[model samples]
Target: MTEPEVSDSLKTFGVVLKALRDETGLTQEEFAHRVGYSPGYVAKIEQGKRFPPRDLAERAEPVLGPLAAKLLRAAARSLTRKVGLASWFHEWAAIEEEAVSLYAYECRVIPGLLQPEPYIRAIFERRLPPLSEEQFESQVAARLARQSLLEERPNSSFTFMIEQALLERRLGGDATTDALIDNLLTQGARRNVEVQIMPLRQEDHFGAGGPMYLAETPSNQWIGYFEGHDSSLLQTDRKAVSSMLRRYDKMRAQALSPRDSASLLEQMRGAQ
Candidate 1:
């Protein structure tokens, strides 16, 4: 596939390869020798400028062996399964499974990490392509499974800065929105969760452009994710990540603190 369709998968593969190399403490030149690729070519692949060919995969199998390639192939398939869903999203899903901290800013809707199963199903039910009932249930289940991160022991630190307009959007109508807000308030009460609300009238805000999430891996590497209509981008570029971090900082500054955010949700519930 061309770069546009397969960009995320290629990058994910690069991450896997680079991790393996780092774990083995092999210099690019040395690793390239083991994998039978020119060091320059290996470097390009590692940098996500090129995809690994079948020949390269074969060469890597011996050094990385079957177990690593098996996992990578599974990742490759998942990354390519949904055309509009970028490969980076699959990798992000994997990262979410092990993340130590997650911070998200949303302008439109609640973050998936904070959504309930019924609400997620309602969101899926509104999709244009119209999923089969079975598919819908499966997706809802998968989305709900993600919420385990909030409840699991040693839960990852979760923070959300959401615009007030999102709460007013009334997705699935007033009752559903109320229920969703109640759930958010309840989840926010958790020891690991910090939820903030940015009022509509706030001025000099950050993230006025769109939504973004910054995740910190267990090892402390930071990656940024932003979604578009048909795809999402996982940005590992230090500069891009830094810019989002700055914007999130600004949003946090403009938002109600977590304690008051929950109070706002309660007040909105009463007003409804």
Candidate 2:
């Protein structure tokens, strides 16, 4: 595991060890002996002073018992939940963090995962109910933090299918749309991010269903997340994920190629 993943793993191990020891009512020495590790080693792991080896986790699983391992996984998930601003948001963030590839379709605007700060702020400012300045900034910070995934080593592949109308939405007026479109063109050149514009003429496109994101992890598991007026759903069911995947595939086929997409953006900029 890389440093970040290892750090996350250590925290997971520490929480698990502490929970298991408490449940078994066993001293460190007792637990270590049963798991075939030295007492000091177990203590170090429980304190998060060191990361337990994967073998250790496998061995400890049986020693700690099924219930303990299950609880440990749940505890790790609980830690992640606290970081998500909303219940549904956490699930999406966690999955996105672990994803190795991303596919998305957006009808009305840019997807938040790829949006620049100015565009994001403009969207927030136009919220129907409006937000306090502090709340708006806090949400902006959260959104920016989520963008860090784009900077990860061995960057995840991103394919975003957005409607052509999104380029004309003047949330912050012409300059904002121009800048945002320019940013999209810049990102489209990156080897990692693949951006496409669905022509306004494609009224029968698969994306007509709605906006959705399909994320695939290194382990090959797929998840779907779709945002709504006041809520979001992190879909884990294979059938649902497959359905979204099909939609994304069709949308990709219908959207203009990356080069053409960039050219289209340039035309919009000149027209503006």
Candidate 3:
């Protein structure tokens, strides 16, 4: 696949930022502290997966010197660069950026934010209408970019409740399943993330309505997102959001705890 068609403006800014970081001889973590952002966020910026925040240049000015002006110009240009997200998903993705808390419950497939690279590719490979190479690359890029959220926002609370059956499905075969398990284990270890597994043999599993995505904005407002076979809905309606939130909370309570989830994942990994 050719490049994912990330914003050139952002890529240019990333190059400049990376060059500056190199000059300063600071690690991504160290540079992030200097600029008051998480290392993962900084890494995304440098990888061109994210646009520079409005205040990034100002925050970075002290270390930039003459390069500060260039960074500012690049930041301005980055705003207009094209993104890889589907049209329907763009709104949800934006909300995700500002979300203080996110909850996802998946019975269909792994949530996009939790999918690993091989798992992502396997999904695309099974598309019915057959996506063109360009479309595949674009979709893959968008999903990979979204996965950064787990690491990029340390302050955000991320909760994922996945069905054990999904892991057992082995969509991409053993190798990919192993990778997914490893990735899930790694992500679950993060202080900000919780991975819960709903066992396969539950008689009281009530999350039959389908997969759900919920977010809490910084202002404490809730948003719900649901995707169909061909379309997506972003529900800002209080009742709709509340309904999804309630289902998610109930399912979370029914799923395995984080520690137990880890143990199950480790056992699965060993089985592979």
Candidate 4:
């Protein structure tokens, strides 16, 4: 039987892993034993038939030292490239995964990190050209995968300011909206998360430019991301990112407080 094809990124990852293992002067079986996996499993990873586990990089640090961790991080980055995300958004997604802090202001839908599965499905179903079965599933998986960032970095902070109109709109009917609000409330209660509402009645809005995302990188630099239907832009210019950060802060000031936001969500849930 013909072997299944491997993605270029995965193949490159396998090559790097094989090189690293060779440099360690240990056989594949020995390395696998150290990492607490079967030799066959290690061989599959080295041959590009399997992806490394999320903790593999950290787990290899003690035995193989820092270089092993770096290679594993590179391999993880390679795996992210194979996801169905748009090319324009790939760089920003990688930065987002490592952000020390994230701020989001949305005028349309809830941010992907806070969206419920039903709401996410409804949003995709409304695509103009419509997605095929495979496309739809891949998009869902990619979006859900991003939520891991919230739990992976306990020190990371996240703030989401969503337009009240979106909540009131009830995009996927009452049931979906109810579930979505409940999910948001649960996320809001987390120590590292702050969810605020941009009241529809506000006359002074700093976010007139539409949705925007800002994140502070691991190196302490700030970046901005903006997206539309067919294109997205990632901003690294200090002036531009700083300006967006200021506007985000102002928008937060205009929005309901976190406490009030939770109360409003509760009221909406009660009304339903």
Alpha-carbon TM-score of each model against the true structure? 0.69, 0.71, 0.75, 0.77
**Candidate 3 deviant stretches above 4 angstroms:** 1-4, 7-83
Per-residue accuracy of model 4 over 137-254 as CA lDDT, tens digit each: 7777777766766765667899999999999999989999998999999999988999999888998989888899998865688989998986989888999988999999899999
Displacement of residue 254 (Cα, Å) in model 4 is 1.0
Q: Residue 257 lDDT in model 1?
A: 93
Q: How many backbone clashes are present in model 2? A: 0
Q: Evaluated with TM-score, which candidate comes out highest?
A: 4
Candidate 4 accuracy as TM-score? 0.77
lDDT of 1: 0.73
**Sorted by TM-score, highest first, which candidate order results?**
4, 3, 2, 1
Q: Which stretches of candidate 2 lie over 4 Å from their true place?
A: 1-84
149 Cα displacement, candidate 1 (Å): 0.9
lDDT of each: 0.73, 0.72, 0.82, 0.81
As a whole number from 0 to 100, the lDDT of residue 155 in candidate 1 is 51
The residue ranges of model 4 lying beyond 4 angstroms of the native Cα positions read 1-8, 11-80
lDDT, model 4? 0.81
lDDT for each residue of candidate 2 in 1-272, tens digit (9 for 90 to 100): 11122245556768677877888788888887887555655665676544343345456677788777676665554343222145456557656655679888888779876778789888888887888776677677767666655655235788888888887667788777877887788777878888999998986777667889888865688878889877898888999889888878877888999889888988988888
Whole-structure CA lDDT of model 3: 0.82
Ranking by lDDT: 3, 4, 1, 2
**Candidate 1: where is the Cα deviation over 4 Å?**
1-88, 153-155
Task: Give the backbone clash total of model 3.
Answer: 0
Residue 208 lDDT in model 3? 93
Q: Candidate 1: deviation at residue 261, Å?
A: 0.4
